[model samples]
Target chain A: MKIVVCMKPVPSSEARINIASDGRSIDPTDVEMVANPYDEYAVEEALRIKEARGEGEVIVLTVAAEAARSEIRKCLAMGVDRGVIVQDPALLGGDGIGTARVLAAVIRELEPELVLCGKLSIDVESDVVGIALAEYLDWPHVSLATKIEWPDGKMAKVQREIEGGAEIVEVSLPAVVTAEKGLNEPRYASLKGIMAAKRKPIEAVTPSVDAGQVGAAGAGVEIVAMNPPPARGGGKKFEGEIEEVVPQVVELLKSEAKIL
Target chain B: MAGRVLVFAEQRDGQCRKSVFEALGLAAQLGDEVHALLVGDAVASQAAELGAHGAQTVHTVEDERLARYWNEGYAAALAAAIDTVQPDLVLLIATVMGKDLLARVAARRNLAALTDCITLTENEGTFEAVKSMYGGKIFATIRAKRTPAIASLRPSAYPVPERQEAQPTVQALAVDLPAEQRARVVEVRKKEEGQIDVQEAEVIVSGGRGIKDPKNFEMIAGLAQVFGAAVGASRAAVDAGWIDHSHQVGQTGKTVSPKLYVAVGISGAIQHLAGMRTSQCILAINKDPDAPIFSIADYGIVGDLFKVVPALVAEVKKVQA
Candidate 1:
């Protein structure tokens, strides 16, 4: 079995995101970037599959800029066998199609039987690339999988998290699945794994697909403007007995919110 | 002339979900032709209902292959729907399933697709949608450059149309799905009996770490019971294993916009606030006056939840009686 883990770097959760003066993009300098937290789960799942199977190559794949090489190397440190980066500068901010177009090409080259990704990039929160890639490959795909079992070479049994319920889906091999949290606890890089990763090769490859078919020309959606969320007015607070505040709340609900 | 708007009718177990009607309302608001595409084994029963909610035409693709959600099957049919309609705008309800299928369809067509939009408005033949980014810290309004611009509305963020007894013309659309499917849902496990879906609930009563014990959630449950509301939990409570993940409402959990959200004992973090801030009314109950939740709440009470929650439940019951 072979596996490819797709990941993107996002600003560390603690880093404050500042909109650049250009008003169209984040000021990349102000924030420290890390592998997306969700992607850690994907990387870990790939490593675990290798451990369980006892023999396979796990490759870290990404469609990002030159800066992302270090991020991919971190996954390599976590015990992946190899790293592949699709380093076309133009692919930056490629809409889902643009991303799928690039990723699908590299995936075809790697020819991994399974591809895993974080459920969504924490930065853009688009949640599209993995499914779009699956579409391009015409493979079975599911998002938010809590549990998965590969019963045979051709199919994997998966329980996907849907609102109000869980859906158990059976997907054929060469399928795509995005990792939601709770899928697994990602392993920290061991001293041995880290040193081994330094010597391991990081391969740089560009998507051979036609750019016009993918990210070019905005891929359909345009970011017309960027702005911060409107500040909400400070609300009323009552410091007293629940008895005192209850009636006031009911009154306000009836008058202001109009739900009562 | 604004071009035709199209919505994909989302259904499960033969019942049309609320988001479809909301999508239809958006379609009606945006364009002259408000058409919807419905696919399933026997979904025609719900066509009249879609018609009542502003869909001028119901495009039905009834087939057994689509009875259960197979991503490829749904995507193929939806891509065909787009081709036939050649709509200027395409809308889908922002549900877990809707998000999964819409992106694939958009990708197959190489169309731009946006998800989790909270609000939208049209001007000069272009529609701009606003949604929070970075765990709700920032808001961005965006548009798609391509015709048949695709997007999904956050659940309950948009209004569903009022029921008017009107019949929409139902037309049959033929779509052929490939024989060998890549993925197919084989089983569905519903949440245990009588528990409401938090995002779909009109009323939500949530608890936080302050509940102190797993058993203490009963007080919060009592309040929810009083109002026939769903029970929700903060990330702290869930991370501590006091409640199930299904009950969690936050950035890492589920986003909900109930009509009335009663948040008890949660010291609101940005993650927790992002999920429920879109709710119509928020009532925050916490002992600390300085708790962050109070800032966004419509009403707040600074007191021990043990003393307050029972009393408030009784008060609500009294008013109802």
Candidate 2:
């Protein structure tokens, strides 16, 4: 069995974002880029499947303007067999559908039996590329899966988290599954694995220019402006006995929030 | 004449979600003919309701597999339906299912899609939307420069419109599940039976690391029960193994914007704020006066949660009674 996991680097949640003067994109020079937290779960789940089967290979794949070396290395350090980066300058600021076209092209070449990705990247948070990739490749896809069981190499059963509960689903091999946070505990790279990852080979592939092949030329969505959400205004604190304070809170709820 | 707009009606237990109604309302404004696609077992029962919300025609796809949201089946059904409707815009509620399904259909046809649109408008048949990023810290204005675009309307961003008295033409849409969908659902385990989903709750009482243990979450639940509110937790609490991931609210968890949100023992991390900042009114109860949660809270009570929670619960009970 061959398993492939898709991952991306996004702005760290803790870092303050600075939108560039272009009014369309963010300035990246001062910001810290971390592996999208959700994709870490994808990498972790792939490693677990490989360990359990004890034979198949686990590979990580990414598409970005420049090769995301650190993010790819992070997955390799966590025990992926190899890494693939489809680097192209045109991929920058591309829409999710175009990106999916390129990724689906690369994955088709690999012809993996199963593919996985994070439910959504922390930056775009579109939840588009994963599902779009599955559709572009013409495969069964499941999103936000918390638990997966491969009853047989040809079949898979997964428990996906919906609005309130779990939906148990079964799909055939050559499927795409998106990882949510509860899927598994992503392990840190051990010293030995980190040392080994330094020598791991990173393969770079250029995207095909067949119009619909890479589809970078057909970015359907364009960013028009960038701004911050209006401030909510600093709040006020209450003081007094519990009885008095409760009434005040209720009055504020009725007057301020108007929910009471 | 304006182009046709297809609104995908999302339902659970045969009832439509508020966001679905909002999508229908928005679709009515954007197009001359507003069509609703109701896909699931017994979903046709909602045809009249969809019509009341501005749908001129309702396309019903009934299947047991469609009961729970599976992408392969829904995408195929939608792609088949689109061939007949040929909509200028396909609008869906930005729920977990809606976001996933629309993207798949869009990709199938090599079309453009913008998901979770907080602000959406169509000009000369072009679709432009605004979506917040970086945990709601920044906003991006995205435009889809094509006809027949796909977009998901964010929940709580738009309001449901008044209902009409007339009924719509409800037509049956047959689904074709492809061979690739060998995945099957064995069971659907509802963890919090009879409890309202936190996403749709008007009031939310959330706990954080300060809750200490899973057993201690009982207090938080007790307060939530008093007001018939849903329970939420910060990512830290979920990471500490105190609650299920479904209860988490933050960048890694579900985003919620209830009428009133009570944050207990939570120091507002930006990631956590990203999920709940849009709540109409926030109340923070924490031991640390400097907690970031207090910054956004409309009302704050600086004290120990163990003591404050029980006291607040009792007071709420008295007021409601």
Candidate 3:
């Protein structure tokens, strides 16, 4: 079995976001970038699957700036066999679909039996690329997968989280599955794994798609502006006797908030 | 003006979900003529409800392959509907299934789609959508650059329009399923009966590390029952095994925007705040006055949650009486 894990480096959750002077994107300076938390689950699941099979390969595929190679190395350090990063200046403004197009092109060459990615990136929060890549590959996709089992090496039994519970799905091989929280606790890179990762092969290539289909020029949507969230007003805090303040808070909920 | 807008009405158990009406409401507001697309087994029966919720036309594609959500099947059905309707804009509610289906449909057609939009406005024949990004630290306004622009509205972000007596024209769309299908839903296990998902709830009562023990979640659940709210928990509570991960609200969990969000004992990490800061009204109860939750809360009470939560629940009952 060959499994590909799609990963991206996103601004850490703790980093403060600032709109760029261009007013359309975030300022990259001073931002601490890390592997998207959800993708770590994807990498972990891929490694676990390979280890279980004992005769399979695990690869990490990413489409990001050249600077994100370190993030890819972080994944390799976690026991992935190798990595691939698609680097192109044109991809800087690529929307989710554009990124999916690039990824699909690379995935076609690899022809892995399964593909995995985070359900949604914490940075863009669009939740597009994984399913879109599945579409481009013309394969079945199960999103929000909390558990997955390969029964007999040709079928995937997945437990996907839904609104109020879960659904047990059976998808054939050559499918895409997005990792959700609770899938597994991702393991940290051990000293031995880290040492092995330093020598792992990572190749950077540009996507061979139409010039009109993989960049800001090919973007179907454009971010016209970026700004801070609207600040809340009339935010009042009361500290003192709980007996006195609880009633006052209830009064406000009734009259002011109108939600009572 | 965008002439025709189409909404993919999501259905479960042969019934249209609340999000279908919410998407229709926004579609009616944004498009000159609003159409709804329903794909599932025996879904035509719900077309009337779609009509009531401002759909000028309802398109139903009935097939067993779509009885449960398989992305390829749903995307093919939606693509067929789009080919037939040729609408300027397509809308779907940002539910778990809806998000999965939208991305595939948009990608298959090579169109631009904005997911989880809080608000939308018509721009010429295209659309501009506002959505929170970077875990609610920033807001981005996105503009679609082409026709048939696809977008998914966040659940509960828009009001369901008033029902009208006028009947909408019902069109039955033919499903052109692809020959190769590799996935099928074998079984769906529903959680506790009558439990409301935090994202769909109008009111939410959330707890955090301050609640102390797993047993104390009962207090949170009790307070939630009084207001008929869903139970939510911060990451700390979930990590401590005090609550299920499904109830967690944070950067890694579900992002919600309920009508009223009551944070009890939650100190509000930035990640937790990101999941809920967009809520309409926020109330926080904590012993620490400087808890970050207070910064965004519309109202706050500094005290012990055990003392304040039960009291607040009683006061709410009294007010209702």
Candidate 4:
């Protein structure tokens, strides 16, 4: 079995984000980048499937700038057999649809049996790419998968998380499943895996599609302005007596805000 | 009218979400006829409710396969619905299922789609949607140029209007689900315990790594019980195994905006803020004065949660008594 996991490089959850002067995007300078947290689940699920089968390959693929090479290397260290980096100057500022188009092209070339991705990237939180890729590839897609089982070569059963409960779905082979956290615990890189990852193949490919063809231009949605939310003002400390503070706060909500 | 507003009434187990009614309230202001599309088995029962909530017409599609959502089936049905309606604007609740299915529909139709919108207003012929990015640190007003401008409104951002006493026209639409497109739904496994779903709760009390230990959540739950609120956890708490992912609120987990949101021992991260920032009244309790959650909270208590939460719960219970 050949399993391909699509991942994106995003700022580490710990990093502080500063909006650019334009107020449209984040400032990437000095921000430590890492694989999207949800993608980690996808990678770990792929690894688990490969281990269960005892014979398969897991390839990690990403579309990022040259600065993302080190992050891609981190995925290699995590036990992926190889990496594919789709780099292009025009790829910057591309929306979800643009990114999906590029990924579809890459998937066409690789033709993997199973595709996995994070349910949504933390950076955009759009969660569009996986479903979009499935549509472009004309393949069945499942989102928010918590558990997966391959009953046979042609069929895969997956447990999908819904609003109130989880539904078990059965789809044909050659499908896409977007993984969320808690799907599996991602393993840490072993000493042996880290050393071997240094020799893993990392290939770079340029998208053959143009910006206009893939609908990269003319973002229907444009960010008009952005600003930090207002700060919470100081509040009186009600440490001495509960009786004193309770009525005080209630009176404030009723008289000052008239909400009560 | 230049643009017709379309609302996707999201339903689970035959009940429509509050966000659906909220979307209709916004659509009523657009001066366009609001048409709602309901998909599921025996969903016609909901058409009257949708009509009372400002939808001029409710399109009902009854399919047992659609009762349990599969992205492909939902997307295909929605795409077909859109083709039939050809509306100028499309709106959905920014729930997990809506966001997942809308992406596929937008991609297939080559239309622009925006998610997590807190507000929507029209300018000229264009509809501008205000969305929070980088969690809630940055707010952006976005305008979609494409026809049938697509957006998913965050829950609780817009209030649900009182139902009007009007009998709306109900249309039953037939959607052909291709044999190859049918994905079998075998079973529905609910969370073992009957814990309230954080996303559907009207009130939520969440904790983070600041709580320090898993056992400390008892105090958090105590406060939540006073208000009949659901318990939530930040990514930090979930990552530390203090709670399950179903209780997690953030970009990766569930996005919820309840009427009242109380954060205990949570130092708000940007990702965490994105999930619940749109909540109506926010209260933050923490020992650290510098916790980011205080930034957006309407009420802040700078003290240990152990003392603050229990005291607050006691006061609430006394008031109720």
Candidate 5:
């Protein structure tokens, strides 16, 4: 029961986003990068599955730069067996398809029985790489999974969130599942685990990818410009007794907002 | 490059969704020929309505294997439609199903796809789009270098065109499906009827940490009921188990941009604001005058939500009556 969890470091949710002078990328200065919030659930779910089985290995895989080693180490501190970081400048800022191709190549070498990833990264919010990776590997993918169980390690029963409710899905082994929020409460790294993580092996390797087929060069989509959304103006506050203010709000809703 | 566009007109339970028409409306503007592809068990009859909405050609892939959305089967169907239509652009409404299918098909063909775009424009057969990043904190205008680039337009971002009498050629596309599906849906559990999805609602009334108790959501629901709007909750309320995640609106939950969004007791964390700052009109009702929610709100009421919500509901009912 080998499981691989895919995670990425993204700008923290609380960080203010400022477009760089290039007008195509965010300003990275003064921004804290952390594991994508959803990826924490992916890591936690993998750990739970491994603990339940009691005789298998879990690996954390990431295609990030050198700065992401700390985030990968955080996953190891939470009890993953080891980590693999694909350090390649060509892989950075590639479109989802290109990134998925790189991940699929690495996943083929590992040959894990199951692969898990967060539903989407907080930075790009594409929600494409995981599903695309599964497609590239020719495996079944269940996105937005809230619950998963594989009693016999052959067939997996997953519960995924849909628009209105839930869908119960079943896929064979060697499948990909994207963890949604509420899948599990991720555990913080203990002092002992942090000490253990430092000794755990982290294999850094550059993938054998075509130089012309990655990064911004090989990306099919080109970003033309980046800008902040228009500022929201007019903060008309009405403060008074509820009886007097309620009508005023309704009057404006009908007349000014014209939304009624 | 051909000035033809293909849109995946997503349908559920034998009826087409309004969001598909919105995609079609945008498609009509971008391409000289607009083709609608509807895939389901028996959805050919709906092609007439899609034609009325502005599709010059309606492509239907009716198969029992596609009764439910099997990603592989639907992707194959879409790929076959793309092969036959030979359009320069592909558009879909960015629903959960749409986003999923688009990724799978794009990966299969190694095509370029942009998802959840808010705006799209064309220049000499090249299509460029603007999409949000970091949950709408910044906007990026992008262009795909490949022909027949795919993009999923966010629902409610484009308008649904008015119905007109037009006849479109209905073509039946044939697709090859795998003998055995790798994944299958065993069951679907849907929420109770009359509960609108916040993404589709025109008006939304949201509650946050200030609501205090789960039962207090009834007041929020009351105001929503008065105007037949959907009820939304902030991450704080959802995290506290006050509501289901489906009703949540924030960076972690669903992002929405309805016509009118009313926040009650929500202090407007940066994440919450990221999800809703693009809304057309916003109204915030919070006890704190300095709440971040007020900064983006068009109308603010500085008072306790417990008192303001009920009175506001009563006044709305009176005004509508």
Candidate 6:
């Protein structure tokens, strides 16, 4: 079996995100960047599936700038058999649909049996990439997968998280599954894995797909601006008996906040 | 004239989710004639309630596939409706299903899509949307360049207005679904029985890594019980295996803004802050006085959660009694 994992580098969750001077975008400089947290689940799930099968190639693909080499290397160290970096300036600033187009082209070239991605990237929080990728490739897609069991070479039983509950789904192979965190415990790169990763081949190529066909450009979705959240105003705490606090809180909600 | 605003009044089991009414209230702000598209089997019965919330017309798409949330099928239906109505703005509740389907519709139609918007306004013929970024710590305002702007509004962000009799007209549309596009949903396995969904809760009591152990969650649950709140966990608590990921509240977990949020033993990392910063009241209980959580907390108790939570829970019980 062949599996492909799509990964991206995003700012570490702990980093303080500041709006740029233009007040429409995040300040990228001086912030620590790491593999998107959810992508770690994807990489780990792919590695786990290969280990369980005892015979498979786990290929990790990333479409990022040259600066993301170190981040890609981390996936290699973790047990990915190989890597592919689709590097291009034109690919920059495209949204999920654009990213999916590039990924579909890569998947077609590789012809993998399975594809995996993080449910959503931290920066964009647009959980569209996997769904759009599946649509583009004409494959069955499941988002927020918590558990997966392969019953046969052609089909897999999967569980996906939904509002208030989860749904158990059966999807045929050659499908796409987006990994939520906790789907699997991602293993850190071991010493042996790190040394072996150095020998792993990483192919860097330009996306064969047209830039116009990818992202919001093709899908007709465009981001007009990104700004900081409004500052929370000072609030008074009512410390006393519950009788005192509950009504006070409710009063605050009705009067000042107008939320009730 | 600005096109009539469109709201996708998402329903399950024949009842409209509270977020639908909230979206309707928001739609009223955009225009006087609010058109709602409801897709489900046997959902037309709820049209009058939708009208009460300001829907002038209810476009009902009834199909068996719509009953169980067929993403591709529903996207096709919504796209077909968008083509026919040509509304200037489209609104959907940023629920799990809404988030999943809107992207596909937006992608297929090549329309600008925004998700999890907390606030919205129209200025000079352009609709601007504000979304929480970095979890909920930062807010980013976005504007779409295309007509029929598509956006998913966050739950609990907007208030559901009182019902008024508008007597909305209902229209039924037929959507042809292809067999290949329908992904089979074998079964819906709900999370552990009795566990409340944090996203739908009005009051949330969350525990963090500071709780020390899984058993400590009982105290948080006790407080939750007193306030009729849902129990939540920080990523650290979830990572530590003290609770399920469903209870996680943070940037990587669930983004929630309950009416009241109580954080116990949490250090207030920016990621965690992003999830609950929008809550109306934030109360933090931690031993460390310098915990970042206090920076945003409306009420801070610089004490051990083990000691403070039980007392808080007891006090809440006393208050409710």
lDDT of 3 by residue, B179-251 (tens): 7667888999999876788988999999999999989989999999989999999999987878888999878
Instruction: Report the C-alpha lDDT of model 5 over B1-321, residue by residue, as the tens digit.
Output: 348999998987788989899999998898888999999999999999999999999999998878877878888899999999888888988888998898888788767788899998888777888888887788788888887788999998988899999998999987888777888888888988888889989999999999899998899989899879999999999988888878889888888899899999999998899899988899999999889898999999999899898898889888888
Worst 10 residues of 1 chain B by lDDT: B131-140
Q: Single out the weakest 10-residue window by summed lDDT for candidate 2 chain B.
A: B177-186
The DockQ-based CAPRI class assigned to model 1 is: medium
CAPRI verdict (incorrect, acceptable, medium, high) for model 3? medium
Candidates' C-alpha lDDT = 0.83, 0.83, 0.89, 0.79, 0.88, 0.81
Model 3 Cα displacement at B241 (Å)? 3.0
In candidate 3, position B39 carries an lDDT of 89
Which CAPRI quality tier does the interface of model 6 achieve? acceptable
Q: Output the worst ten-in-a-row residue range by lDDT, candidate 3 chain B.
A: B174-183
DockQ of model 2, rounded to 2 decimals: 0.73
In angstroms, how far off is A29's CA in candidate 5?
1.3
lDDT of 6 by residue, B1-321 (tens): 455788998887778998999999988888766899989888999999999988999999998767877777788788878887888888998987888887777767766777888887887777778887667656766777656778899888889899896799999977777666336677876766666789999889999999898998988888887778899999899988998898999999988888889889999888898888878778777778778888888766666667677766665455456
Comparing 1 and 4 on lDDT, the stronger one: 1
Model 2, position A6, has a per-residue lDDT of 90
Candidate 3 at residue A59, lDDT?
89
In terms of docking quality, model 2 is medium
Model 4, stretches more than 4 Å misplaced? A239-260, B192-194, B269-278, B288-297, B302-304
User: Ten consecutive residues with minimal summed lDDT in candidate 3 chain A?
Assistant: A226-235
TM-score, model 4 to reference: 0.92
Error of 6 at B170 (Å): 1.8
Clashing pairs in 4: none
Question: In candidate 4, what are the lDDT values of residues A80-105, reduced to their tens digit?
Answer: 99999887767655667668878888
True contacts kept of each: 0.73, 0.77, 0.87, 0.53, 0.77, 0.51
Candidate 4 chain B weakest ten by summed lDDT: B132-141
Highest TM-score against the true fold, candidate: 5
- For candidate 1, the per-residue lDDT at B202 reads 95
Compose the digit string of candidate 6's lDDT tens values, residues A1-260: 89999999999998988878776677898999999988999999999889988999999999888888888889999999999988776765677777887888888989998999998889877667888888788787777888988878578788888877888877877888899877989898999989988899889877688867654455444555675565775346444554345555545544665543
* Worst ten in a row by lDDT for model 6 chain B: B312-321
